[model samples]
Target chain A: MCTMIAERASIQGSGKTENAWISIDSCDIYYDHPDHVDSEHAITLSFSNQLDPINSRISLEITPESAKEIIRKIKAALSKGDSLER
Target chain B: MKNYKTHDYEGLIAETIQFNSANGDSINAYFAKPLHKGKFPCVVLIHHLPGWDELYKEFTRKFAHHGYIAICPDLYFREGNGSPDDVAAEVRSKGGVSDEQVIEDISGAVDYISKLDISDGKIGLFGTCSGGRHAFLLGCSTDKFDAIVECWGGNVIMDESSTNEKQPVSPSSLTANFSGSLLGIFGNEDTSPNPKQVNEHERLLKAENKDFVFHRYDGAGHGFNYYDRPIYRQEQSVDSWVKIFDFLDNKLRS
Candidate 1:
C-alpha cells in the first residue's frame, strides 16, 4: 500500500518556525525542512480513489502522525528560506 | 425570560409570497424584510434537500434582520412537508431532486426579486445542506449574484463514472467557472465533505485562480446552522453568521 501526505501553512512574523509530523498506517512522513521555503509551496500527496473487486469505497485517510510530519516539513522549509520542491 | 420565536428578532418582518419559475411552476416563497426597507439589497435564499421548512424560514428572518431582503422559495413543491421528520424521510427515501429543477426555481426567485420595487437589483445567494449545493451551482451559472455562501454541501467532486451514471451537477467542475466570490462553511465532522474533499476543492480553486474562502469549524457536525437541529453548534453558527454578513456587506453593497 502507498501513502500520501499533503500540507499547507500560512506563517506570521519572522524568526519563528512550526514543525508537524504525520503517521499513517504505521508509516511516518515527517516534515522537518528548513524555513526558507515559501508558504505557498504546499506539500501534496496524490493517489487514485479506486478500489478493486469488492464494493468498498476508496478513501484517502490522513492520520495525525502524517499531518505532523507534513507540518514539520513546512516549518523546515520556512526556516531555511528556500523554495520548496514538490 | 420568555421564549421568543425565531421571527421575533428585531428589524425583521416575515411574509408569504408567490413567484413563477421558468418552467411555469408556481413557487411559494417566504420573504423576510427589514422593518424599514426601501430599495435594499436582496438575497435569493435556496432551501436544502428536504425542501423549505421552519429552519429555512428562520434563516431568512435572520438575514433580513441583517438588512437584506431574504426570499426563500419552496424548492420541493411536489412533496409538501407535514413535519421535519417527514421532510427527512422523504429526502432519504427519494435521494435528491434534480439539479436542473433547482436552477429553474432559483432563477424564478431571482426574476421575482428583480421585478420588485423595493429591491436594488443586487442579490446574494445562501443555503444549507442541499440548498448549499444549489447555491454554489446557481452562483457559478449566473453573474447576477454578488456573493454566495454555501454550508456543508456534499458530492462536490464527482467521478466520470458517477456523472455518467447519475448525471448530477458536479460542483468541483463548476468551481473553475465561478466568477463570483464564494464562502464555504463546513463542519469538521462532516463525513460527506471529508478533509480530502475540502483539500481537493481548495486545490481546484487555487489552480483556477478563483477568489474564495473556506472555513471548517472544529467540533461541529453537519447542519450546525439550524438552531433547533441536534447538530447545531451555537458558537460556530454565530461566528459563521458574522463572517457571512461581512462577506455579503462587502460584496453586495454598492
Candidate 2:
C-alpha cells in the first residue's frame, strides 16, 4: 500500500540542492512505496530547504526493519551519551 | 468505430507535452497514439505513488501500439517535475495530493484528450497502486470517463481511521455514484486492498447493481503487475494486461 504516514519537523542544517548550498528548513520521514529500493514498502526520509523549493534536499529509502533498527541505535547512542555525561 | 482487432503492430508517436491541469496549473504529460487515420478511443493512464516515470511511458506506448490514444498526465506537475524520487518524497511529506485535485486533474486529462483529432471522445482510465484508488475515486466523482481499471489500489476501503485528508472519503461508500463500469484486478495476498476489501467493495457494487468485474489471483501480491518491481508476477500481470484491453474495448469500443 502507498502509506503517506509521515512526520515533519523543522530543523537547522544545510544541504545542497541542485547546484548551490542552502539552509535546510525541515525534515520528513515516512513509510511508503520505494522508487529504486527492491522492497514493496520502505521508510523514506527527506530533508529540504522549503524556501528553495527546487534545490537543497536529500532523501533516503530503507526497509521498515532497517528503519526500526536505526531508531533503536539512535536511541542507544543518545542514552550512552547521557550516561557518559552524567 | 474502426476495427483494430488485427491491425499490424506499426509504431506510434510518443512525446511529452505540457498542458493545464486543475486550477489552470500547467503540467507535463506523456501522449501516445497510433498513426492510423481515424478516430480512436482514449485510455487515460494514471501513475502510481512512484510518480510519473518511464514505466508509465512504456505503458502509454503499449496502449498506443495496441490501438488506443493514451495519455498519462504527470500528477506531480504541481510540485514541479523533477526526479521521480524527489517529487515523490515531497508529495509524501505534503500528505499527498487531495482527492478533489486528483479528480480535477483527471478532468484536465479528459479535456486534453477530447480535443484531439484522433480521439473518439470515449475514455477509460487505468491506474495502479495509489493511482488505482484515484481511478476508483474518479469513477464515483466524475462522469467524463466511461470505464475504470483499478489495479490493487490501497486504502480504497478505509474508514474514519482516516490516515489523512488525501483519502477523506472511502470510495466503497460511493459505489452507487460510479458513472460507468469498473474492472478491479487484485492479488489475494495483498494487504492494502486485501482480498476481503475487494470482496466487500464488490458486495457494495453488486448491491447497487453496478457493472463490475474483479479478478483476484492467488499467488500474486500488491503491485504484481508492475514489471519493474520485485513483486511483479509475470503470469498474473500478463493476464491482467489482457483484461485491461478487453475491458477498454468493451467499454469504449462497444
Q: Residue-wise lDDT of candidate 2 within A1-86, one digit each (tens)? A: 57667899898988775677778889888866666577767887788888754344587789999999999999999999999999
Candidate 2 wrongly placed segments (more than 4 Å)? A14-23, B1-9, B163-165
Alpha carbon lDDT at B236, candidate 2: 91
| Candidate 2 Cα deviation (angstroms), residue B79 | 1.2
lDDT of 1 at B100: 82
lDDT of 2 by residue, B1-254 (tens): 22345565576899999877867877889999998888999999989987888888999998898789999998987786567767877777777888888887888888999899888889899999889999998999888889899999888888878745666788878888888889999999887888888889889889999888999998998888778877888999888888888888889887
**Model 2 residue pairs with clashes:** A16-A56, A17-A56
C-alpha local distance difference test of each model: 0.66, 0.84
lDDT of 1 by residue, B1-254 (tens): 12247886456779989889888999689998887747788998887654577778888887887788889987766555445333433333344467787888899989888777888878899987767777888877878788898887766666675453223658789876787888989988776566677788779988999879999999886667666645568999889888888888888885
Off by over 4 Å in 1: A1-86, B1-10, B164-167
Put down candidate 1 lDDT per residue, A53-79, tens digits, no spaces. 011111223444555687799999787
* TM, every model: 0.69, 0.90
lDDT of 2: 0.84
